[model samples]
Target: MELTVLGTGSAMPVPERVQAGYLLDDGDRSLLVDCGSGVLGRLSGTGTGYEGVSTVLLTHHHLDHVADLMPLLKARWLAGEEHLEVIGPSGTKSLVDGLLDVYEYLDGRVDLAVREVSPARSFSAGGFEVAARETRHSMPCHAYRFSPPGSDRDPTDGPLTLSGDSEAFAGLAAFADGSDVLVHDCAFPDGTDVSNHPTPTALGEVLAGVDVETLLLSHLYPHTGGREREMEESVRTAGFDGEVRVAEDGLRVDI
Candidate 1:
């Protein structure tokens, strides 16, 4: 599988980083995780257009995370792509309704389906087996674990995880345990305590003993500037012996 970082900024847009969005591609079968602001354009910049996205999963309803939801749906409609099935938290149905209601003109012009997910449960969507666990964020948030359809064994050689915008949680420690690659929230650099989000220090501590092949930091806050080296070292100090790289928009990583 190949992991692509479409946008890695958290709550704010920064140079080369837009918002929290990513794409996990296992050959042609792809899953889009969190369609935040700037994602539609970023997808094009990455040379991976939105037409190939068959499924989308949102971690929460935060604006930085779901800002471009409707735009993406509309884009697919205009591009002649088939309708997409969206899976999200409990309020997802209502949120989708509200969004469409605002753009009521587009209603019925496009076809869409929705599924409200149960926390800490596993479900299937578009040939992917997904597991979700709640996370500590100001708003309702979830961390998603995805594996290929009908196979626990990863087609890309191992498992892949997307730790949504979240604070350090025991749930996530358990969420990504034994996975091949962990795409975690490093919104802040080490030593920055802003609550409901994970700084590298706390994340490193929690992941110190966990079993993971690599750790890639995403959801970067603007304050993370000038501390990139420190953050990388922090994860290393906590016993994560695999790959650690600060996310950059449009970067593609093979897992």
Candidate 2:
């Protein structure tokens, strides 16, 4: 399995980073975890064109997280790939309809299917056994854990988790308790008390007991610039003895 960071910025745009997005590829299978602003272009930068992505797993309906949703669907259509499977939170279907409504010309140009997922449930999609759990965010958000289909390996062994925007909470930690790679939201550095987002101090406490092979801190803000080492050390101070790395756009990891 390979993981690629398409974009690493939060809602606040930074020249150095784009919005939140990622791509998970396992040989012939590919799953796009999010389609935020500038993601389509970053997808191309990863050398995996838009046509190769047929499944998109959206965490929430935030603009920064879905600004390019319609553009991606249309790009695929232009590339002769008309079918897409979009799974997201409750209002996903409605959001798709609303997005397509704006671009009336592309309404029926592509075969887009949307699934609104429920928290604390497991489902199958695109060769993945996915588990979804609700997170403590201002809006409805779901953190996802993805494993290869039909393999009963322990969750700690290989399942990769994407922790959507949330404050450090036990529910989210439990969802990602034993993951191979946890791409968590590290919106800012420590001493920042913004709600519904995790700083290193807060996330360190959350990950203290979780057994993750690699902690990939993502969903960064401009404030996180030049503070990567501090973030890693904070988590380490909390007793998480795992490899911690900050996520950057176009970062590709093969596992």
Off by over 4 Å in 2: 149-158
lDDT of each: 0.81, 0.85
Candidate 2's residue-wise lDDT over 73-160, tens digit each? 8899889997998999899999988888888888888887888888645776667778788888999998888886556864334479
TM-score for model 2? 0.95
Worst 10 residues of 1 by lDDT: 149-158
Off by over 4 Å in 1: 150-158
RMSD for each model, in Å, please?
Answer: 2.3, 1.6
For lDDT, the strongest prediction is 2
Give Cα distance to truth, residue 80, candidate 1, Å: 1.9
Q: Which one wins on TM-score?
A: 2
